[model samples]
Target: MKYVLGHKNPDTDSIISAIAMADFLGDGYMPARSGDLNKESLFVLNEFGIESPELPELNEVEGFVLVDHNQEAQMFDGLDKSKIEMIVDHHNLGGLALLSPIFIRIEPTGCTATIIYKLYKEAAREIPENIKKLLLASILSDTLNFSSPTGTEADKMVANEIARETSIKIDEFAAKMFKAKSDLTGMPISRVVSADYKEFEMGKFNVGIGVFETVDPAPALERKGEIVEAVRELQQEAGVDYIFFAVVDIVVDMAYLIMPTDKEKEVATAIFKGDLEDDVLKIPGVVSRKKQMVPSLQKYLENV
Candidate 1:
């Protein structure tokens, strides 16, 4: 049987899309998440009586599919590329789409579930009611209920159709789901980060970090100083490469990417067509790292 799985740091959209793909492929496939599913996603899966399959060791797997995210740097430790049969995702391409023997499906939609829903229709597969509900919920959660800059007309349309089929009121369900996700009082900064981190290879640099701004960049900025200090203290952390953090403002379509690299700053200045201001790039129309930043950055790296 062929299996499809998501990257580490699985989100609602990734989890739900994997489930939907499993349903679409039926007997020939199973769906999995690479890491421990987030609480939000876990709630959805359990609530719907769906259990996401465990991520199989990549060496033992003969066939695989990719969904939601497509970054080799963020894939599970043992997932070998030779086994993948397809890559279906909504995130901006990161060179993995060109890998041989993998049928690539990428669309610039708000959530990957939106794309998966289309596949469901194209394959003439009937999505279960609860699965449809989860898909709609995933879109709402990932797109910040259509407030994110990445949200598209198609996203809203699919979400509406899915909501109707699932019999869930969009506004009320979105409100409840968003509320459940926004409670992050006692969690450590590291966990909050690992819950949404992405790693990328930029030219000769191996950069990895998370992006989000809850209170203010000021808190994260202060913490960055401490984190840098700690990194200096312990020079042998496993995943410690060039770390770049971003304070993303969805409303402004800009993010202050905080990093301690001259090369990254130089590249950002070139991409923005202007000099960076105090290590901050005023990137207009940039929102999600998956959707906005990574593609351009990857192209920039390829050129360099």
Candidate 2:
């Protein structure tokens, strides 16, 4: 049996794309995740009566149809490293194995779910009402409901189609989804960081951690200290050679990269092709990891 899955930090796009792929593969395939679904995603699943498959034992299985996330750490507990036959992701691509996939689909689009939605359309497959709801929710979550730098015209089109099929008032559903996500008051900083952690290796010299935050103003300012401390703690615990987190201000188009080491600053300076100001780097009008960050960093690493 084939297992379609994604990273442990299973975001909406990852979750929805895996399910959609399973739909395409029919009954012989299983849709799975590396860990627990976030509260917001869980709420959507419950509303649609879509039960998450039991967390799969990362053991022997047919080749994996990886989606949304490609980090090796997201695999099943004991699955062979070579068994990941396919990979589909939209995040910063680093640390990928030399011969990891037989079919790799990496796009610069905002959401992997959008890509899956396109595949369904191309194949002339009717997206089930429940699955459409999930895909629409994934687009809204990842794009911050059309208010994110990651959003694109294609994303908007897919979202509209899914909402129409699901009979959901898009605006109303998105408002509720954001409200649920922004209710981050009591959650620990560690949990918040883990909610969206992506680890990247920069050559053999540095490792970075990137986390996305969608909150603004008061809440974001309130959480900054906690986030900085949490990043420090994670650096030690994860034992990465170096760690950094870029807090992207969606409206301002500037990034405040928080790091515990100067090596991170050095790498950022080289990658962004900008000087470090006050020892804090800035990437003006910079957004989109796939389109901007990863490509720049890869070149910088290669040169170094």
Candidate 3:
């Protein structure tokens, strides 16, 4: 049996894409997750009456069909590149030296689910209501209900089609989704930091970046002291040049950069045009980390 899985520390797009892809492929292709689901992903699954994907036991699978992410570092830890039978992602193409021709689709879209919807159209396959819910939820999660700069018209159109078919109010549904995502009340500092985190190869530096997108930043801010200490320990554990954790207020379009130390704060102050009030760097109009922050970071940190 073939297993479709997403990157580690699976976000909504990653989790839903895996489930949707496996369904699109019909029988024999089973959905799987690289890690546990977060509050929002679990909310969506329960809302749609869909079961969460199980963790793929490597030896029990034939090969992988990765969704949402293409980078090897983000992939299952022991997964071999050669075992990647197919890939459907919206991220930049990574270094994959496959000896054989493998199926791959990488698009510059706001969400991987958007591309998957296109695939369904091309194949003349009908999308089920559950699959449609998964796609719509994934798009909304990634694009932050179209509030994110990474969102495009394509994503909006696809989401609209799903919403209309399901008779779901976009704004109302999005409000509920965002509310579910923002409820990170009891999660530990470590899990909160790593929940939506990923490592990237940025200008020779292996940077580990994490973001906790919330509607109300007050709850996370309450744990600010513990978060700083957690980030410090996580940086040491990740062994990256830097571990940057940002608490992004989606509703306010603002970010509170958690600088673990003076050195991180200084470097962040240099990189971002933001105010460093204590260990937290307050950045305005910097919501989408992928589109807004990554490019500038790559340019500025090229030499360093």
Best by TM-score: 3
Assess candidate 2 and give its TM-score to the true structure.
Answer: 0.82
Q: Per-candidate TM vs. native? A: 0.79, 0.82, 0.97
lDDT tens readout by residue for model 2, 1-304: 6788877777767777888788876887788886666666776777789988556655547667888877665554576768777777777665667453288877777898888888888889988878888888889878867766788899999888777666799888877765665456677777766676655665664555565544443464456677778878888887777676766555555566665567778878766754465444656666455456756776677678
lDDT of 2: 0.71
State the C-alpha lDDT per candidate: 0.69, 0.71, 0.88
RMSD of each: 3.9, 3.4, 1.2
Candidate achieving higher lDDT, 1 or 2: 2
TM-score of 1: 0.79
User: Please, what are the lDDT tens digits per residue for candidate 1 over residues 1-304?
Assistant: 5777878888788778888887777887888787866656766677678876687655557788888877887676777777777878886566664446557889988888888889888978787788788888888878877767678999999988887776788888766664445445566655655666667776766666666533234455556655444333322353544555566554445566654567657766666553356655555556577656766676777677
Local accuracy of candidate 3 as per-residue lDDT tens digits, 1-304: 6889999999999999999899898888999999979999999999999998889987777888999888888998888778789999988765656789989998888999999999999999999889998899999999999889989899999999999899988888888988998997788888999888888887778878889999999989999999988888888998988778999999989999997877667668888888878889999999887887777776667767
lDDT comparing candidate 3 with the true structure: 0.88
